[model samples]
Structures are given as structure tokens and as C-alpha cells.
Target chain A: MNMKLETIETDVLVIGAGPAGSTAAKHAAMGGAEVLLVDKKSEIGTPKRCAEGVSKNGLEKLGIKPSHRWIAAEMDRVRLVSPSGIDVWLNQENVHLPETGYNLERKVFDKHMAMDAARAGSQIMVKTLAKELTLKDDYVLVKAESMGNHIEIKSKIVIGADGPESRVGRWAGLKSTSKPKNMESGVQFEMVGVELEDTRAVEFYFGSVAPGGYAWIFPKGDDIANVGLGIINSMTSKNAYHHLLDFVRECKATQKAVSVEFNVGGIPVGGPLNEFVTDNVMLVGDAAGQVNPLTGGGIISGMQAGLIAGEVAANAINEGNCSLENLKEYETRWVEENSLSFQKYLKAKEYLLSLSNEELDSIARAFQGSDFERIGPMELLGKLVKVSPKAMVKLGKIF
Target chain B: MIISEFCMYCGECAGVCPRNLIEVGENTLKFGQKPCKNCQICIQVCPVSALEVEG
Candidate 1:
């Protein structure tokens, strides 16, 4: 298996074989373009840096079915705990929302996605770390180290599906750097033997326990869960790990939990970038900050961005015009679908970060006896204003 | 910048570096040749307190 590595040429080269890169490679290959997908890890998915929660509707929209193989648990309810220990429960019966989702086994799920791309005829490479990129007139030359062997890939288009710590975006001259206020330092522990109040429920804790963010318990099984928390460290000097340790010590859901694995990451909660495409290069997924600012979820949105970018890249290549102008269609389509909502989420998150523990408790108290089915967004905001008028001044910008 | 032994090589600091002066491999963290202007955004975003300014 030790063959001399040489220069490879393709129509599209996708870096990082996560959901975004694999999906992009599949779509681009389906469009009749030669595609190459690579990841730095020896295995596609291990040491997952996520809470592993996804909505059923999101999967359905992408034509993906929740298979038993990759689904760890089916979620039915959400429990939000306030600063003063008030519990607010939301389910489909009460909230009139779908409320059905899955906690995935990301390792299996990611490998399956890479297999899909391979079935679509895209070349797959593991242990391939992209080191640098040189932009030429017609193609970008990517210098990568594959399996301890130096190699170069020349492609008409390059899709950067790297995570938040993307190097490709910087190589392409994109403004992808995040400010301290816009980033959430996240840490999680996959623990077994946890005593969960509801095996099918996802739990969240707010206020001083997780300043400027929230602590979460995403159940993987009846007795196993990923207990985690994220924080905007600019708001608090405490790092995410210390905050999570405090949560594990005090939160009832994780009190009996015994840790098996630990993972840490940074989430770009600043919304999508202003420009994700340059001449012959495009950035998708966290590389472009294509994450929901409010909830800090990126998988679904990253896949969506990947699909759009892949299709556009293929079309541009087929037409023999891989310029920035030809690739702007991906940006336009993504903006049409997410820009407005993400902007609103960013604004709401900013406003929420300014709230105090007392304000959060008061807000949670307002929902204690409210009828979730009857309460709309405006109605809920009106109630929050009534209880905490001082904190509702910027309500207009959020909604 | 000094990366302590507490670093798990999670790459949080690499993402926020304005000068793109950090590189994260599977288990290794490397600083680029470019000079750091002490933005300290990287230090603030570390999930673990692994990075600190050099004394």
C-alpha cells in the first residue's frame, strides 16, 4: 500500500471530511465533476467535538432518514433550568413544535457520509492535512501531507470545509477570524451511569452556572449522556472546563455521571461571513461561520451550505468559468435561505448575553404557567417585557 | 505565546488568531513565523487555560 504519492488533479478539492466536505464532494461528484475529499484525522470521525443533537425535520429536509445504526437516542422533550432552579419543560404536546430529534453517534454517522461520497465516485483520502494553498489563474495548488507523504493537488475549485480553526479561509484571503465576544469556548464529557430525570429529554441550564451561554445534558442512552457547557470567556474569566466542572458538581442530572471521554472546541457564534467565495476558492461550514448563532448548532446548516456550494462549483466548472463572479451563486442562495434569520439570532444572542441572573430568573418565571401552544413569539416577548421591562429595551432589534 | 502542557491541541486558539500564527495538527500545536501583536483573543477563547503570554 506504500505507493509513491504524486500530484493529483481534480475539478473540485474538498478539505476536511466532516459533514460539510463529504456532502459537498457527493454533490459535486453527482454533478459529473471529479472530486477529492480529504481529512486530517486517520479516521473520518473520532473524538467528536459536538453535543450530537439534530432535529428530525432537518434530516427529512435533506432527504436523510434517521437510521438505527447511527442514532443513539430519540429526543422527545427539552428541559430548561433557570438560575434559581426553576424548571421549564417543552414538548410537542405543549409547544406545538416538532420536538422530535436524535442524539447521533457522530463517529458512525460521519463515516457513513464519507462512504456516500465515495459511492458517488469522489476520491477519499484520510490523514491528509492541507498545509498551504497557492492561487493561480485557472486552478489553486494545494500543498498537503498525505499519510506522511508530501503531495500536491491542482484543482479548478477548492472548497474549505474545515472547522472553526480553518487555515484555508486565511489562505484564500477571507475575513474569517473571530473576535473574543463572538466565540463560545465549549467543553463536553461523555459520561455513563448518569441519573437522568427523563431518558428522552435534553436538558439545559442557564445563568451564572454557564455565563453568556448554557450547560446541556444530551442523553445518549437511558444512563449515558454528553454533559457540556459553553461560555463567552470575555464575559467571565473562568474557562469552559471549570464552568462545566461546576455544573457537573451541582446539576442534578450529571451528579451521578462518571466521565468516559472529554472533548473541547470553539464555536463561531457570529453568523455567516460577509464573503465566503473568492476567485476559484470557496469556504463552507464553520470555515465561513455558517452556524446558528442562537443555539450554536452547525451540522445541518453546514450541510446545507455544502450542498449549495458543491452544486455551484460543479456548474461553474462545467461552464469553464470558475471565477468569483461564477461562484457567487452559492453565496446568493445561502444568503437567501439563512442570512436574515442568522442576523436576527446574532442580535438576540447579543441582547441575551447582557442579561443578569436575576433578569434570567424573572424571565423564566414568566413562563412558569404560560400556555405554550397559545403563546406566539410576540406574545412571549410582551410577557417578558412586562416582567423585565429594563432588559427588553432592544427587543425590536432581536425580532 | 506559551502553550502549556494542559493543551489538548483542540485548536480553539488557531481559529481566532488575527495574524494566522498558529497551526494545529492532530496532537501538535505550532506557531507560524509571523509575529503576534498580542491580540490575546486566542488566550481568551481557549476552552482549557492552556495558552498564556510569554513572560
Candidate 2:
């Protein structure tokens, strides 16, 4: 195999131009680092795999203005339906900033984020795939393919913000493999031309309908919605797409389905990877398993981690130290900020997954007549702890 | 080349393309034959079926 070696230099190199990668590039460039962001795809967010629901707090932290072209609708409430079809409605008062849900146009949102990184002076290379990572004397070498040519870029630090199936993390020598039981395969569909009254509310169906996972209905607008469902592979050997199709049929949403777009993906339900960094390399976003185990959301946590990783990388480079010890600061920042929430959510998911359909129905029924304030996370966790003291004890160890 | 049913109308392919060869419409995301430079990055990263080169 005859391959050409072309060497370029940068202060920081970020792999994958997704939410996390772009955010890292933006922050690194803002910190005055010569950052290069690369993605294998020609476009930034074309495939539309995410559910596109971000909490208001998450958006605020990123300082992003919710664009009219990007927002499908604002959600203020959530309904959790049990196995027996008993619905428990939680109003805005119960959830944190319920009135500020974002139904994002992921393609536009992701592209705009990359543009922000570019505006911050980060160079973005589209259609460039990072094939492998190699460590030389003191720099991390990024071997990539761009337009049938082999390109090599050297940087003092490399950040892996790739998705769940991240090769960059693995190439960087991090144990990034997710167990089958820890991963949930998900499928989502964008449905247009459907009339629904609760345009500002997102709905979730739990228990038997989703087994270890849940089904969601996030409204985009008056008649457009993103209907999706996730199921842990360990629960049943059924493909996520088939299960999602069955749920769609059961809900009778398929009857009026005019135009539907499908996305088949996976979520790492595990809390987080054991290690997020090594010498001169840090993994952020789904690549580091930074997703919320309960809601399967990663945009907020991913971006947050990206910011920390970027800062840590730049600092380490400036100090002439890129060892694992220096990179441990990124790990410390992430754990101090979001590890507790992730652990709590993971415990909640485990307990919820262990319940029988009848138990789930009972829990849903118990909350059916109750107000939203009565079903907060603390209250829900307290109830679960009461039921399963052993599980609660395990969660206590992490806290 | 024809756009597939998987297109989500994200308008991303057009934004990233150097040649401005792709256009997303109301119902469908389409690609024009404005000579795509045969850059297959769009095909590699397209989450849905918005763009593809003719066989």
C-alpha cells in the first residue's frame, strides 16, 4: 500500500464536526488556539438522527439564540403513559424550565454551530475522515483522507467528539466499547401533515410499549412531529425500527402519515465511559458516553464536556505538558459538574428497567391523579429507593 | 441522481457543497447536475437520502 504523507500543523485538532466537536473547536479557537475541525461528511447535520430536544438551560449555557427556522415548537409539558395506557401528565411547574423546550432543526442547528466555530477562527474541513491517530515524539498525528488524498495533520492535542460508534476514541487507545446491555437501539421518524392539539407538549410512552426504553412524541409545529422510540437490545431481540413501526401502527399515527423520514441509531445508556482522557487525547460527547441515561440526551452534556476538554487541551499545550495527569483535569471538571446527575439517571433507568409491566402500570396509575409537582425527579427517586433499597444503596456509593 | 424518501430537508448538503449543486425543496431534497466534482463526502455524511451520484 503506497500512501502519501502530508504533514500540516495545528495547536488543536478536533475530530467529528457534530455538536460536541463544533463546540470544542469554537471554544478552543476562542481561546486563541489554531484549531482544525474535521468531519467525514460533506454536510454538517444532514442525516437528522437526533430527537432534537434540548432543555432551555442547555441552550442558555451555549448562548445560542433559538432561531425561528430551527425551532419546530416549544414544549411546556410532558405526559408519561404507562403500559396499561394510563397517562400521567406533568405540567410546566413540575419540570425544570418546562416552557422552554427546543425542537431543533438538527441540520441547520449543527451547521450553524460549526459556522460559529469558524467565526471563532477555527478551520473546518468537510468530507475529511480521520482514519487513524499516531503519536510521534511530542505531537499527536491525525491521519485523514480528503478527496482521495491522504492528509496528515500534527497537533499538540486531539479531541474526540465523535458519536457513540466512535473510532477516534478507540484509535486513541481509550476503552470506548459499549456493552450490548448498556446500549439501546433507537429509531425515529419525522411525521408531517398530522393534526394534533397539544403542539407545545412532548409525550412519552413507557412500560411495555418501549420495554427497557420509551417512546416519545416531540411536536415540531401544529401538524409536524418527531415520533420515535428506543428499546434496549437485551430486553428483546427485535430491531429498533420494527419496534418503532409497531408503536406507530398501534398509535394509529401511520394512518395519516403523509411524509415520514426514518432514523435508526443507538444510545449508550451506560452512565459514562470509565476514562475520558489519556495522554494528549480527550474524548467528549457520545464518544465518551456523556449521554443522559434516562432521557438519552447528549447535546447539553456533550457541549459542556467539549468546552472543558478544549480548555484543558489548550492549557496543557501552553504548559508544555500533555500527559495523562494534565488531561485528568478535564475528567475532574466533568465529574464535578455532571457525574452526579448521570449516576442518578443511570440508577433510575436500571430500576425502571427491572420493573414488570404491572409494576410500571401501578407507578403510572399512582401518579395519574396526582399533580405534576408530586412527580419530580427527587420524589420519583425517593419512591424507587423505598421500593428497592439495595439499588438505592448502590446509587449512594456514587453520590 | 434522484433523492430518496429518506431526505429530511435539512438543507445541509447544499450548505456544505462547494459547487452549490444541491437544492432542497418543500417536499423533496434534490441534487442538480451542475457537475458535483464527484466529491463523495455528501454521500458519506448524508444521514438521509438527499443526495447521491448517478451510477
Candidate 1 displacement at residue A118 in angstroms: 0.9
lDDT of each: 0.86, 0.75
Measured by TM-score, the strongest candidate is 1
Instruction: Compose the digit string of candidate 2's lDDT tens values, residues A313-345.
Output: 778867888889998999999989988877778
- The TM-score that candidate 1 achieves is 0.95
True contacts kept of 1: 0.73
Clashes of each: 0, 2
In model 2, residue pairs whose N, Cα or C atoms come closer than 3 Å (at least 3 residues apart or on different chains), thus clashing, are A47-B47, A72-A220
In candidate 1, stretches whose alpha carbon ends up further than 4 angstroms from where it belongs are A1-5, A93-100, A390-392, A397-399
| Per-residue error (Å), model 2, residue A11 | 1.1
CAPRI classification of candidate 2: incorrect
Chain A TM-score relative to the true structure, per candidate = 0.96, 0.92
TM-score of each: 0.95, 0.82
Q: Point out the worst 10-residue segment of candidate 1 chain A by lDDT.
A: A92-101
Q: Which model scores highest in DockQ?
A: 1
